[model samples]
Target: MSTAMSAAWPYPLLADMVLAVHFGVVLFVIGGLVLVFVGNRLATWPWVNALWFRMAHLVAIGVVAAQSWLGMVCPLTTLEAWLREQAGEASHDQSFVAYWLQRLMFFTAPEWVFAVAYTAFGLLVVLAWWRYPPRVARSRG
Candidate 1:
């Protein structure tokens, strides 16, 4: 019976789930750009009320972008690919964004490309930060 259960769950689905979470976080960072431009709609969310959270999110994205730009591989992508390989699954192979990005995260990029991308992402991050300086609570006496 125990062997059956083990066989049923041979792969670590948890790692895949974590990869999904990483993807979601990436989406949020990109989407947050739209939110910044759209309006104060994000403020409506209770979570957004926390300045620290916003700052952290912004920083996290900035770091990811920086890593990408520096030609440094993303740990999450490497881990995901490794997990897939371990599970006897073929890694992604294609072009456009996914193929190349997956490759970039797995294999390092050229210095020039990394520099250019990093610079661009850094600019975007700066713009976003300026637009939405973390909200501060007012203290009433």
Candidate 2:
């Protein structure tokens, strides 16, 4: 194919990759808590109680909640939109994958609904932190 077509081809693929990453992050923030609680209960997956893991999980959800409350768009969403536009596609209405994922994660409700939902989820993450307190590594003499 022409150079122009070759150059343009990667944009849609890159956009899809970004969408996949965004989906993974959403899953981590939501599912991480389940792993933490259940793993702790089962006494399996000890790494779930690691301080760093717990803190990172908390921070991820906290950012989402804060962005919603501040009426700000997520950076990942912005990047995906820009990439889709570069690929000559509408940000949210283009590919089947994008359309379905957007429908699953996004809604046309008022801003406060998102803010409240995110805030509630964030609170749950915080509670998980307390419920399964992270373990501190001891120094060996």
The regions of model 1 sitting more than 4 angstroms off are 1-12, 41-50, 92-111, 139-141
TM-score for each model: 0.64, 0.88
Best by lDDT: 2
Best by TM-score: 2
Q: 16-133 in candidate 2: lDDT tens per residue?
A: 8888889989999989989998999999788899888898998999899999988899998899888877877766546788778777777798999989988998888888878888
Can you give the lDDT of residue 122 in candidate 1?
62
- Compose the digit string of candidate 1's lDDT tens values, residues 1-141: 576546635444644654666667666776765666554554565444347766766787778777866667677767766765555556552224444444434436567765676567667867766766667766699
How does each model score on lDDT?
A: 0.61, 0.85
Which consecutive 10 residues in model 2 have the weakest lDDT in total? 86-95
* Cα lDDT over the full model 1: 0.61
Instruction: Give the Cα error of residue 129 in candidate 2, in Å.
Output: 1.6
Off by over 4 Å in 2: 2-4, 91-96, 138-141
